[model samples]
Target: MILPETTTVAADEWVSQHRYLRDSGLRFFDLLVAVDLGDQVTEVVTHVMSADATRRAMSRIEVRREERIPSLVEVFPAAAWHEREAHDENGVEFAGNGDLRVLITAADPPPLQRSAALEPRVDKAWPGLYEPGAVSGATRRRRPKPVPGVNEEWINGGRQ
Candidate 1:
């Protein structure tokens, strides 16, 4: 049975901590991802397992927008793609990866970042809100609130 173990490490200690975990037992790299905590910090987490898959570990490093955590590509080559995706989605930089190309959309602010606006929700009308000429004499009740994650100022040609 593989029990999950988690450790939160400082950004500067990220690479070293992963190396320590690898030396201890977790040798098989599983995956890496980023989570936006909405506190101006992005939590980057990587999961790994022992060679026999009997042990598992998860390492987390929190970094602010301006900070770049050291890349683990040297220790786990599979981390390169995951790092690129994280960078593309959340704008988290991996210092040594060297190939942090945009793996997804090329939006100015990363889409998954908390500060990034959800333009589609603002630009398009919610399907449930209106159906033109579908219902006869169905008087509207009230103004619908903007969709979640969309600013009220950008709704109904409110703001650009």
Candidate 2:
């Protein structure tokens, strides 16, 4: 009954961690996408599930400004489309993913990632940072919880 935890992982470790999850009981691939954090960091998120879909965990990889993340398609083929979406929306570059082609019709700025060029990413602030307001309007915070007994080194797709 536990929702997939959002575990922050490094770009290099993404594949390995996901591979480990696949090798383990969580063999079901769920989803993958990214959020433009607007601080030179795009938070890439992916989730996997147990065969029954009851047990799952989310993995978030913080891709720093100008950093290229490795592709997860090698481990989870489903990542292909998700990575394309991230690239089309947020301009994130998944290094090994060959299909980084624009997923949708978009301009140079991309639809979802449009901070004023003159201002720093932090100063410009990502539009829709608050869905409607600071309170009940949106999920303004990360409520990610870790899976029990899953260590950071491997569980949730971090480190090891």
Could you estimate the TM-score for every candidate?
0.76, 0.68
Q: Cα lDDT of model 1 overall?
A: 0.82
lDDT, candidate 1, 1-160, per-residue tens:
5547678898778888888888998889999989998768999999998888878899888898898899999988889999999999999888999998878787878989977767676667555556456576686666566566554555543343
Cα lDDT tens digits, model 2, 33-151, are 77777657778888899988877888889887588988988888888989888888888888889988776756666656634232233344333333444577555475235444332
| Model 1 error, position 57 (Å) | 0.5
